[model samples]
Target: MTERESSRYIDATAADWIARLDRGPLTNEEAQALEAWLAGDPRRRGAMLRADALSLLSESAGALAPQFEPTPFAPPAAPPPPGVSRRRMLAWTGVGGLAAASLGVLAITTQPAAAITTGLGEVRLVTLDDGSTVMLNTQSGMRVRYGDTVRRVELLYGEAYFTVVPDQRRPFVVDLPGKPLRAARGTFRVRKLEGKPVDILVDQGGVWLGEAGTADAVLLRANTRLVLPDAAGTPLPVPETISTDHVSRALAWREGKIAFEGDRLDQAAAEFARYSRTRIEIRDPALAGEPVTGLFAASDPAGFGRAVASVFDAKVEQRDGAVILTR
Candidate 1:
């Protein structure tokens, strides 16, 4: 295809198609057309997914911005038959809050900055104007600031996985607890657990870790996990290497599950609490260090409680919005 032809159908067209699909069940003709368009170009599918996901997230958050209608692409050579006119096309494609996600995707892309937060047991996916995507885990918050020179994000709390689309001129930087993590092209996960060290896990590409003001930095490559120094500024005794299996286990939360490998019972309980309103308490200190293994739903507090109780024959009590276990 010629360069002009390739550039003719861009993300804006894809976004319009996404808006249409989200509205309602489409006619077979429309459906076939969409499928053909998607199959025609690989990039089109990616654009549609990003736009649709972003719209969903905005809808879920109860904040849909005003509709943004870019200039519609030039109408085809021949107008549609009797019922299906270009006006009908707009009607089918117009932003409808209930029919599908609308307004927010356009707003986020054009706005200078935005902030997002997810409550307990909630996961959010965001598509930035730069075309990067971010998945926010439960109880996480972040602020995005985009400019001509940089695309910046401040991870206020909790964990987020960034799938960055490279922009060589504008570097993507994530601000964590102690240092700034920068990437031009890559996917990575950054986590900030309460009272724990900030963790950076690189799944694809690489990240530069360093203070916000200085030039000194550490380059961490793919499949590597780095745990920064503790609050006391004490580094690890030795460089820690995380295995692929362990990385997968840590990221299991993305799938609404948690993997435990001989994790302390108390520690496991704490992790589960992040995804549920009901808290877990171990009354007996002796049982706090008990080993726990296997995979379980992040929000299944009752199931976890029952499993623990059956294993240790411990007493399980349901208190005011909390679960207490003891022997």
Candidate 2:
């Protein structure tokens, strides 16, 4: 095969692997095959991350599998083919049954609770028995456990955007590392920061943040953001009210892009690391603190690293599967 054709074949294979992995657990043989493919070529790993096709497969894991395509997995909802509206497409694909089972519209009480996780650069949408929806970011996972009196979800790691269905009879709460955010009705985003506190952004309704039994708690209303306590159990400051614009920037990863405005280089790299295997190393501590601003594709850390290198007149090198930047 020609060089370009060979590259395209590898990319397509990586995309297919991602779709298969997203469907659920992989068999032992499948896992080994995937590892072998990734080990064959370093560039193949990048192709895998950029594919990130799980989010598209999220809606039709089993029954509707034939109807949904994962080839071009772009976010923010692409329009259906020329004559088809999204609702009609869903109806035809048989998504309603799966969605119903997820949202407790069906008798999910007899079912076992399962955790959902997304691999690097992958995004997944999960619906709970309580009718709540969670959009998990790359390298994220959560556990769902519901009971007669309470609906609880544990954010094991990473970030997720939640859309809740209010249940006055049973409060819905998300448990983070240090504390839990309880809500009777609301939509919010929660991110578990590495080596720091969990961040909560409430877009609608109300959220109560604190240790479940503690008297010292805070209320988070619409358009509010706050850092919850650290693992050390440090206290949180008063939540800050934010504008819709700020909220949009924070959640821009949902659209397959990361938006930054006057953010430090180190911070930007950390954000990018969540979506790709490409490691961004700032060899110069001084350069790490330099501020940067822009929007870049979440799956293209090499491009972002090059952009930073150009802006700062630094050097970009690839070593040991990592992108290292130096001045």
Candidate 3:
């Protein structure tokens, strides 16, 4: 192969590895193969990181510019045509160069607002201009709006954990649809999963949960959780005090792990689905109902399946890109 042709081939291989990693954690064989490929060429590691960063930048730009539905997680049915991957990689190079050049200037300016989103199985930590930080979970979206009067953020969808800086003149407010959560200095988490009530967990200090300028706002204290109502007039449930252990388990995703305590087998499967394209199917109703308790890697559905199979005396089958459990 010519020198340029060989370089393009390496870029294509790196892109393929990144796409596979985005789908789910690699199997043992795939992991070993990737290690071998990297060992063969030192440039391959840098190519992989470059491809991944460019891909993330592309996805972020697409998310902010348009209102389009995100593609659901699914295994790749077939490989791309020859040279297609290389062409895509070449295209990213130009875009990535322009983006990198502009990022430094954008960092220093005061932007009115910015939209951010994370793709499937991706976790991101974003630091705001006001010295606060936000950790976004998988498949999450939000808009950060910092103004002269207040630091406001809109949770468009999904979940985020926030650590707010103490600014008495400008309170930090998180807008959840119609409800607004306000705090001056605190650490908290807000989850707005589809088909479920908005969940608010305060880790340190306190926050006011209600509409802005309202007199009946509820105060949520530290180490407490509240399941806010979806409907406008529905009465809010009292905030429940949570233990330190519970907080650690609930926030386990920060470390790319899922912690379960006597959760149903099917429920755990659904939770894992959020982080991987590999579906875990429970064929037997009895097996699906069995209680499970453990901490598992979020990206490794296949490994989780093996663990469940060993514990329940079930069989684990890999077929059509899914992990099926049978008894």
Candidate 4:
């Protein structure tokens, strides 16, 4: 990699895509974006899956688990229509293969796995091809697997909420990399917290939970709960009335928003910084202690700054495209 290109690794926007690809197949839009990226500059595709390079934030994944090929839950479908291939004939034909070879294929495959990409402060839901879904919270990532025997999803990084459609005989399982938070066959939610404890919140038909290395399993009825990576594998407090409001608030990212209710000002600023590309600098540290409340459009940094300013009698300034919050 050239010095310039190497320097830009941390700034690559395709990091998230690479992470998702690590889990499973890309959607039509993702595939096209990746192909266009490949055609634009060959380096993109190779950089994505190559074991050598690590994401800007994750050094451990640099030694990622083996390349687990993605298999669709159903039969392999037909290939793309003929027109699409004809259009890329020139590029694929390699009239200028030698010249473009320098670009490589990494960019096409790699997706971002930055700490800010799927960490605990935000919630994101991804729709799979088969109508099932995956929800990513502030700081979590899972390796996606869908195949003939089982629809397996490995939580490679942090925490994620999964809602799988029941395939009856073919059960859905969620297992942490080195631990256990297993559940077999049902519609439910399981979150694998990195160091704290893995929590299972069963919302539908009965599901089972077992340790990472043992056969000891327990069946959990609806509205069941448990915290694991723990010794006893104790059942946590399952609120008879599960307040999705907290879940919904925690999961605001799926809607491209961040809802705060009198959360500390500093915390609010930190959350806003994640969705925003440009950095945010608070000029007055004291303001960080102030309380903030309301819904903020995550993609709208300017609007958030205005909201803060107008609500708290603060001032917003822009210096070189970065938001400077001051009071």
How far out, in Å, is residue 85 in model 2?
Answer: 15
Candidate 1 vs candidate 2, lDDT winner: 1
Error of 1 at 184 (Å): 2.0
lDDT of each: 0.66, 0.66, 0.69, 0.50
lDDT digits (tens) for residues 241-324 of candidate 1: 667667667776655667788888999998988888899989999888888776666766666776777777788887898889
- lDDT-wise, the better of 2 and 3 is 3
Candidate 2 lDDT score relative to the true structure = 0.66
Model 1 steric clash pairs: none
Candidate order by decreasing lDDT:
3, 1, 2, 4
* lDDT against true structure, model 1: 0.66
TM-score of each: 0.66, 0.62, 0.66, 0.49
> What does the lDDT read for residue 10 in candidate 1?
59
The per-candidate count of clashes, in order, stands at 0, 0, 0, 30
lDDT of 2 by residue, 1-327 (tens): 644437688878877875675465566576666767765665554455434423332433121121222121224555434333322222222111112111111111211368777777777666565445676777787888888998888988888887665567898889866567898766789998567667899877778887555788789998999976544656678999998667767876665667777788999999888777779988999999988776666766777777777778889898887989999
Candidate 3 runs further than 4 Å off: 1-112, 211-213
Name the lDDT value of residue 313 in candidate 4. 78
